[model samples]
Target: MELDRSGRVLAALSVAPALAMAGWLMAGLPLLLLGRFAPLPMLLLGVPAAALLCWAGTRQAGKVVEATVWQVAGVVAVAAASAVFNGVMHSEQLIVRRDPATYAQYAAWIAGHGGLPISVQPEAFGGADPWLLFEGVGFYGVDGGVAPQFMPGAPMMFALGHWLGVPFAVPAVLGGLAVLTVAGVVARLAGARWAVLAALTFAVSMPILYTSRTTFSEIPSLILLFGGLALAHDALGRPGWGRGLLAGLVFGLAVLVRVDGLRDVLPVLAFAGLLIAMRRSSRSTGSARPYGALGLPLAAGLVAGAGLGMLAAYLLARPYLSYLSSSVRPLLFICGGVLLLTLAGTAAAPMLSRIRLPRWAPAVGAGLVVLLMAALYVRPWLQTVTRDPVTPEDRRTFAMIESIQRANGMPADGRLLYFENSLHWVIWYVGLPVVVLATIAAAVLVRRLLRDGTPFDWLLPLAVIGWTTVTTLLRPEITPDHPWAARRLVPIVIPGLILLAAYALSRLRTRRWWVTAAAVLVVLVPPAVTSIGTAFTPVERGEAAAVEAMCAELPPDASVLVVERVTGDRFTQLVRGMCDRPAAEVKRAGAETAPEAEVRRLIERVRAAGRVPVVLAAAPGQVAPYGPATHVIALVTRQDERSLVDAPNGTWGLGIDVWMAVAR
Candidate 1:
């Protein structure tokens, strides 16, 4: 009985990874499939898929727990870290007013008026609107036009939020949770020590923590990308028909999450094919059974995933077909490449089996995969190569990068609820190719791990380093060594940290445990302090208070214009609710200023609109000439840096300080 129980446990352990992969894929696959057929198919497919996943996951939990404590701990830690990061840093107000809200309202405006489409033609060439979140409409800058450049993922998430709640912060918080799920899942795959490191890296290394609380879909898409990879790995390692089916489901689901995620899925399928090839080659004599067993299930899975994804795309596109020309073409290119690669990989398998192959064969096979990845990287790479004029978006992004590039740049203004524009710079500078490279490297590492050396894997670290390197290269802001800004490197930070921590624990050297403990303390402190500070203080309060103070100082009848930083969502709520403010409030104000000298003209217009108009500037130094001011009030001030706040305002406030200026 004892021996039988042990054997059963071992058998279950061997199949666990595949089972997990299949379960997740099964859960997400139907939604993707349903999407392809019709939106209503979601009810037909999702209920079944979700039920299977839950059942499979629950059944496996006991066996997984029995296999290793590290797995449990890693999963819990990654999830906990993500939760802690967002829980501490995220807030309701921050979520609703973050950058995306500006776009959300614009989308809503379009939806309200016959679902107008927005165009996204940048004056500068090589500008990125790569994802096409709003290809249904165009994002024509801040005009709230019909055509916005945003992708469907973000708008869909926002739309869901609008249907469900007020504040819209709930979606942002949920976005953070999605990020947490990715971190947790990745950490678990990396192992316990690495998992903790991954969590730390995610928490502090990259902008994942920051995005957790924002309405942005990038991080959520990234999480889905990782999920696809993990599930594929699980399926490949298990070698079961059901698992392969699940992998297909996951591959389809990934495409549904974000278009970029599809890039990561390619290498996973290639790796799976490699496994299938290996299994085929290992069989003695050409046997039909082996070929059928390996190829049929995999082919079925491929069809399911691809078919489902295509179905979803068509269904989603049905409502708005005209705007999809540019968007749909890229997917076609991807599909064509996938088909060509699959054929090539299949054709080359027999040749790869030969011991004394043609001299150019290895180079050719290797070169093909490399070229495919190179092609994918090219567009994003070129975008980074070109630089644009530094506007408000540019400066804000630069400051974010500088925070990471410079050690002391973490602004003391507030800890939590601050948006990092630098992350975009990092991603662009870094290139989207790293996602592909990391997935490939991780797959290779997993293969090596199963073959058995020390059971240590390099996938996690490769992912982190590759992402960080790409991010650092593309970003105009941030040097390589910025400490607080180090969050940009979160992809690899946790994995790298885990290696160090693991090494410390395993080392027989004197006081090694102390070193590990100290490392944990160091990693835990920054986030802990950030969380504490964020909980007690509001990140938006400085700007919010400034806006409130500026409003209070103005007369009820006066026309006040905020001639700074153009327009964005941060000021949206205030402007929209202006009519609802108290009796002492001024008539509704507006935000004005061009990215260039036209801002001065706009300020002049405000001065002309009323007698002794109160023009409050926040980032005054960014603008020039301070233009003739009767009474200028500086609601916020930064260091002696060139910005809108530094323009020679007659009165200024420090912290909560108030100052008054007499009309000239």
Candidate 2:
């Protein structure tokens, strides 16, 4: 089991692809910003940049023994298999109701046009009728443009799939990339041997699988975060400016994928500052060991990455940014305060280092960690977190909760967020054995750090993972559902806990096969089986074909006016983007109803604009009155079910019908 310098270099090669994947994602930002997202140009710049990043991340990796040939190959095989399986079974979430479709459509427009502010094409719709709304769910209608929700980072990566003519393949690759990065971190932090165990445990979990099979931002964010972790671990040892710069860039670029990434990397910001502070302290002052020379570049890269993300948000996706202003404002404030505190800590480093700690402090801290977990479990009995349905979104959330409650036969309380059961959600996904092992590892690691901070590599990662995990467990902010709510845990908690849990298992000095097998079975079985119902069952099949057929029916220059509720909710963007037509959904005359007067007036306007007007509906009867009804889309698929009170067991039936009439 002994390793040499060659082992260290081999470990670097093992993780190099993971870092390159992350770098490629980051590299797309410039192309997207410049509105020149051509494949040739993107690959030309991205390939070499990715290669450079791999070199930077791995150059100093030779300082640590983190992986072996067998271990690396084993982890890679599992990761490759995950990517292929996920690709084969990937969901065709082309219609907009949730995030996946939003991302699909977003990436679609970007790939097709290589620009932002998706044109509303008001000229075809007779100059923006008051009776029409250009936006669909997750797509916002700005002054004269359509904007996609969420950060552009994941979509930027997904755009490659469209450029390559295999859109789902991007998610599959990212899913696999996520696995490799997880293995890399486990290899570096715990030991080289435990990497595959951690990878297997993580790859089979429902959250990882679920996010990977669809276009969720979580997978890309997870990859970037963990890829950065792999780089940062190596940099912490050799303290090269390039290594720290790349690590911090990817870490901060995660914010480009998800806004909450800012919150997640707060510890990184703090750790960078701490490193600078310790670097200034002298041996005469009995200061802790300096972290060589990593802090400044790491801090600079983080700031630069964050600045780029915010700039992209401001320039390209303004409507989405405006909508998230309330949440974004507070996060910005918190970051500012943390930066100020870091500066203060640096100034006071010498004074801070002279302080001493009690030997029993580690034991006390460990006991407190256990106490916190126990308290979270006991919290439901004492507290019920609820908010009044005051805002429009709050009311919608309340209604969704009530419907889910009724479906599950639980008491209907629209106000409940179910934040109290957060830890239980973790159990439902990763199992009790993992939770036990992770808790033990975290507590023991904390104890070791306090007693003697010799396990120096664990410093920044533990700070980052532990902080995000605990904060999220305390207030998940997402709706309480099996996989939907589990998005909060996907990026960090699931993988972080599994890695630590594996590290804990590696500590067991047992030679017995039965003992090892029992441990593996206990830690791995529950999570792998938890998602049994849906892992093999693909959702939203044949949806892309249905959409294509629907799009093909409409002429390239047709102006679509959707008059039905379901049709508008589902096909607004599909018509606008895929059909390459100007599409608008009439504003509701009543509860999810289109006003006949407005619909007819819009039809006249479309005619006046010298374009074929198409009236779209979910039924033959709804569109037949305009002209002769043409059946465009008939889709029958399954969708993931929502649950708040109890865990979701399976999916529900989904049916989509679109009918259109071309008015001459």
Best by lDDT: 2
Itemize residue pairs with steric clashes in candidate 2.
Answer: none
lDDT of 1 by residue, 333-356 (tens): 876786688667666765665545
What are the per-residue Cα lDDT tens digits for candidate 2 across 1-664? 4455535654665467556765676677778778777788777988788898787677646356646667767888888999998999899999887789999998999899887778888889788778888888888877658888889988888888898899878898888878888887888777767777788889888888889998999988888788777777777777767878887888888888888889989998998988887787754465456474788889988887777778778877777877778787988899999999999998898888778798799999889878887888788898898878988878888998888889878899998999988888888888999998888988888898888875878888888888989888988887676678988899999998898898888898777888778887998898887877678877888899998888888877699998888778778887888778888899887656687777888889988899989999888888877899988888899888786755556788888888889974
Per-candidate TM-scores read: 0.52, 0.96
Measured over all alpha carbons after superposition, the RMSD of each candidate to the real structure, in angstroms, is: 12.1, 2.0
Candidate number of the best TM-score:
2
lDDT score, residue 154, model 1?
A: 41
Give per-residue lDDT, candidate 1, residue 424.
Answer: 33
